[model samples]
Target: MPYALTCTLHLRRQVQLLSILTVFSVIKAGHVTREGEVRWQLFNECSQGMLQTYLGRVNTRGFSDRHCLTEFHVEADFYGAIRLQHAQSRKYLCFNKRQRITLRFNGDSERCYFYERINHSGYSELESAWQPRLFLGFNGRGRFQSPDTYHVKRRCFYWLKFVRYVPEEELHHCEIRKPVDQHVRLEHTNMAHNALRNSLLNQIRATHDGPYKHQDQENRNGTYSL
Candidate 1:
């Protein structure tokens, strides 16, 4: 092939790749960490498995071992900031004036909260904006209270662990996702991309050829086909 033809093919391929990238970006923006609501399951590595809503339930004011029934899916902001709220009770976990984190039944004020993974491990500790030293954890007894003191027996035991949670709706949005699902999705996307490219190129060719055909016919006969 001539150099000019080779260059034309390369330019066309680049444009096609750019268009595919643009489409993927628009489709994926909704699923990134930036958009929609993100959730994390508060898992305790040593104590009760899951961290749940420790609302003013009967004998469950602080923290409990109940799994899903404890309620309140966690909501996190950018930079790993988080707030736990019970759906039915409409209560939010807020830091109180006592320098401890507590469940507030009703409040509109936004408090500062940040969480970080410990040693790049799955286990994480949630930190509060007001109290710098203390973390969100259960005390000597398994309760969901951020006491000022650390656990004397095992300091690492009480530190909270987190797993980025996906809601049921989100699950439906992506069925084939697992730890290795991203690579699969990319492969599937790339494999199917050629068909999409062919369709787009066909549409472009039809659009470009129409006007030129009409102009050529007019020049030959000095008349417009109505």
Candidate 2:
């Protein structure tokens, strides 16, 4: 073989190896820390809402009166595989055989696992670990939809933000005390529920002056259920 041809072949092999490494690098960039279990609110990037689990069903909502349904226990591995369990219901978020996202009590099954693919901007795409090709995404109507497309508009549905979950009591305390650094206002998010609860409690305390006085006391002591 000619020396020039041999050199050309070597260069091509190097280029092919580099391309393979680049693809791996992109996948590795999404690796989540294998630390202890953490709580998170799955914030959808396109829908601009949080993922909620209710009665073994899954959907994204702008705001919900039941805030606990929006929180999930995130157990992530080094390779980005995760298991999300609803904090309130203790149900595992699973992708069913029917290609739908659902919740079940048994979390040990393979269907409960999801592989996280986070991008440079900290947005994550959760692909089903049972079927890696299928992604946990949402439709335009903010309903759960497992996307099977390889390269067509995946970000609009699959991309999400794993926001650290903060308890409503702490948020409410900060708002009541009027913290200087933190701006306190209710928008179309989870915190809005707290604000509404407070408003209802205040109304109960002010309007009920007769037989409901005991209920007013409970409201003042923060034991009120609205």
Candidate 3:
């Protein structure tokens, strides 16, 4: 074979391999589905609790705690960017100047957005869109990835799994919700976790005060959407 032809073929092969890698990267960087009212429940394995909003502060709470507060309406575009709004307060999640995750009434701010990346282990990590270096994690906690740090086998605290939470009353809309499972599942077998997260938030207290009063009223009217 001519030397020139051999060189051309080698370059062409490299180009093809690059194209394939690019496509695979796009596939792995999954995007958020915009199906209406499809909420996502964020569970932190280390904390063993669900991420919930309370009085505009973000924290993890046990499953038996304020249930609706744990659910969030995630809005996203085709590029894997997401914004989370508390299911009850309708408040969007945002990071303050101090890097603390808090709730805000407006979702338009850049601080409210996050870029989600799913690890090969099938768990997901959320990094702030406004401040790329910072990630969502427990307040005053979270290790930042850096050149000096060595990767470890244990899961990082910032890594959290999103579980789909659908109320039994919405069973009629199951078909509409199916499309989002692929992104939420990410090849991880969390059937038991899903079952526990999907349990209805039926234990809301009657004497619940503060923000609970507003949510309780909305629940009673059965008009709450998202």
Which residues of candidate 1, in runs, are more than 4 Å off? Answer: 1-36, 54-68, 78-80, 105-112, 120-122, 144-146, 151-226
What is the lDDT for 214 in model 3? 59
- Separately for all candidates shown, the number of backbone clashes (residues 3 or more apart, or on different chains) is 2, 0, 0
Which RMSD does model 2 reach against the true structure? 17.9
How many Å off is the CA of 83 in candidate 1?
1.9
Q: Comparing 1 and 3 by TM-score, which wins?
A: 3
lDDT of the structure predicted as candidate 3: 0.59
Q: Write the per-residue lDDT of candidate 2 for residues 112-193, one digit (tens) a residue.
A: 9987664444456777889867777776566865475435766555554444434334333212233453333334554778
Per-prediction RMSD in angstroms? Answer: 26.8, 17.9, 22.6
Model 2 CA lDDT for position 88: 69
TM-score of each: 0.44, 0.51, 0.49
Higher-ranked by TM-score: 1 or 2: 2
Write model 1 residue lDDT over 191-215, tens digit each, in one string.
7998899877666552435533455
Q: How accurate locally, in lDDT, is each candidate?
A: 0.49, 0.63, 0.59
**lDDT per residue as tens, model 3, 1-226:** 6778677756655653353233222232486322234466777655667777765566665363445767776677566678887777778988777766677888888889998755444455677898865666542232222211213323434445444544336424322233566756764658766666655333343335533355557788986735
User: How many clashing pairs in candidate 3?
Assistant: 0
